[model samples]
Target: MARGPVGQITRGTTGTNRLRRVDRWIARHPALRRAADPLVVDLGYGASGVTALELHARLARARPDVEVLGLEIDPERVSRARAQLELVRAGGASFAPDARVSFARGGFEVPVPGGRRPAVIRAFNVLRQYDEAEVPDAWSTMAARLSPDGLLVEGTCDEIGRIATWVAVGTDAAPRTLTVSLRLAGLQHPSIAAERLPKALIHHNVPGERVHAFLGALDSEWERAASVSPFGPVHRWRTALSALVDAGWPVRERSRWRLGEVTVPWEAVAPG
Candidate 1:
């Protein structure tokens, strides 16, 4: 069989906790917990495999038997990751077999060794370099490799992961939800999230776009709730999100908002 296209290598400047929000989200995903075949793939996990290792450690909390594989197109990057794993193991690190969080040389073709289909594929910051037109096909190709009930989480985030957004996609490659996660301590306006939206919504942030209106409403509410800023940043966010719901924005939950995140059904923000 012919190997798939080996895309351009990313800058690969990864760091610890740079993908924590997505990791936390994946760990709590129902599919990850209940998968009879709990295999997750971290596609294009940059120069360092720290994110993959961290993902394994966190997701294991929900499914201790889960297997996490990090795939990269760069062979040298894979070798370096293997060396890091060895050092971690020699230091009495707690991780599954070397197989649990192993690195593989592959591209979006998602060549899982032994042809294993993944239950969850976290491809953060992987498609930022590709044209937005390529996103849908890429999503389709990856979701096709799911083990029945799989999820393809594709999105981007700032370097430190404080401002992040992702689209949760089902096995059929249909987007189900849009989640915006941030570090709310210094939040100026929800529009700041516009800078971090996934590929689909990034270019749609203009008049006549649902995402644009959603963000506009959020910014308006944030200002209207400025009176509560004295109470605290969290209080202000809660007030703004409350206004969003009151304004029929269909915001997700207060609990999630309190954690510097809010998820909306994809229908609410899907392109017109």
Candidate 2:
């Protein structure tokens, strides 16, 4: 008589290290670092649970007590992940045997046992398949399950994980920041991030939209900063991003430029 998971099944396309860009970002977030519970959820983790294991391994470097729970709506996926975990526990896998991780069957409702609310919920490429009109409700349903100071990181990335974009949503379901991370080596242009933008702003990347203008500026700066390419992509990125700061882009986190990352207030690209 119980109800079913609140979301739909996804294509389950996954690859090793495909989420490294995002995982590094989450490890530094306060929701995972300073949480009283330090419970992180990998919601809709596709057909494999390796991403969840990878997340735990990376985060544990910062929060040794961090716990990662991989949730999937399909019971079969849950079984498969548990089987993978068993190998890990038996020293047959690469991850630490005592890694604090688990697998569960759930969805956007984010069902967790022990009355524990997750400090961070990461749903990547889960909502991109849904219609744009349904994004808000999906975000609200997931964000509502977070702790008071928790964060909901939702985003999309390329198949190989070179380009990525995500939104940091608060417990109120209001988006706080938009981040674009790319592999600077042999990069074409920063505007390439537009193709991987999260669902909320993907369709709004047309002319007259704020996101479009932002990407335009990003590409323009990248092109203008080509003079520094001989030095290195990091130098090129810093030079380009510095120009944006001077041009009044309201870019945040100057230190992250070395990583080819740019974080801006959500309002910067919110749909007009």
Candidate 3:
């Protein structure tokens, strides 16, 4: 007697630790820290539920009462995740036996039990296959299911998660910021994230768009910081980001630069 999921099934491509970058960012976000209910939704959690389990483990460090519900439109995927959860409960999986994580068949509708709105909904790699015009509707659908102060992180990452970029959307369905996270050890240029830009900005990374200009600035600063390469990639990244701030790029959370992340207000890179 359950209602059908509201979205289409995706390619379901996912991997272990593939979403680590965004998960780390979420761990420190104020939205999760101040949530009264602390319920998180891993919308369209792909072929496997491992990322959702990982999210629970990581976020639990910030709020022990946090609960994670992994939702998938594919019932077969849900069945697989439930099987994995059973392994965890039986002491045969990497996750804690008591980890507050569960899997269900759902999509943008975010059908949580008892009609509870979530504090955060992460829809990574979920909209990559959809048309650009479809994105706003999808964003609105998910954002509508959030708590008053909830966050909707929708974006993409590379195969091994070295490069990731995400858009932080609020309950109003308006994107607030765009964050690019990289593994600085061997990073060639910060512009590498340009390839992984979130769906909303990917097609807009042209000469006239704000995101393109921002990437251009990032690459220019990276080249200018070449002298800092002797210090280490982290120092070089820090220098490049400092240059952006100096150029009035509206960067946020400067402290996270050390972790190879740079977040800019969405207005700084939103499509023109």
- Report lDDT per candidate: 0.86, 0.95, 0.93
**Compared with the true structure, what per-residue lDDT tens digits does model 2 show for residues 174-209?**
999999999999998998998899999999999999
**Model 3 segments more than 4 A misplaced:** 1-3
Clash count in backbone of candidate 2: 0
126-190 per-residue lDDT for model 3 (tens digits):
88878889999999999999999999999999989999999999999999999999999977778
Error of model 2, residue 196, in angstroms: 0.9
| Clashing pairs for predicted structure model 1, backbone only | none
lDDT for model 3 = 0.93
User: Per the 3 Å backbone cut-off, how many clashing residue pairs does candidate 3 have?
Assistant: 0
Q: Which 10-residue window of candidate 2 scores lowest in summed lDDT?
A: 25-34
User: Who wins the TM-score comparison?
Assistant: 2
Winner by TM-score between candidate 3 and candidate 2: 2
**If scored against the real structure, what TM-score would every candidate get?**
0.94, 0.99, 0.98
Tell me the tens digit of each residue's lDDT in model 1 across 125-218. Answer: 9888888898888888888888898899999999888989999999899999999988888877788889888998899999999999888998
Q: Provide the lowest-lDDT 10-residue window in model 1.
A: 91-100
- Give the lDDT of residue 135 in candidate 3: 93
**How does candidate 1 score on lDDT?**
0.86
Greater-TM-score candidate between 1 and 3:
3
Candidate 2 runs further than 4 Å off? none
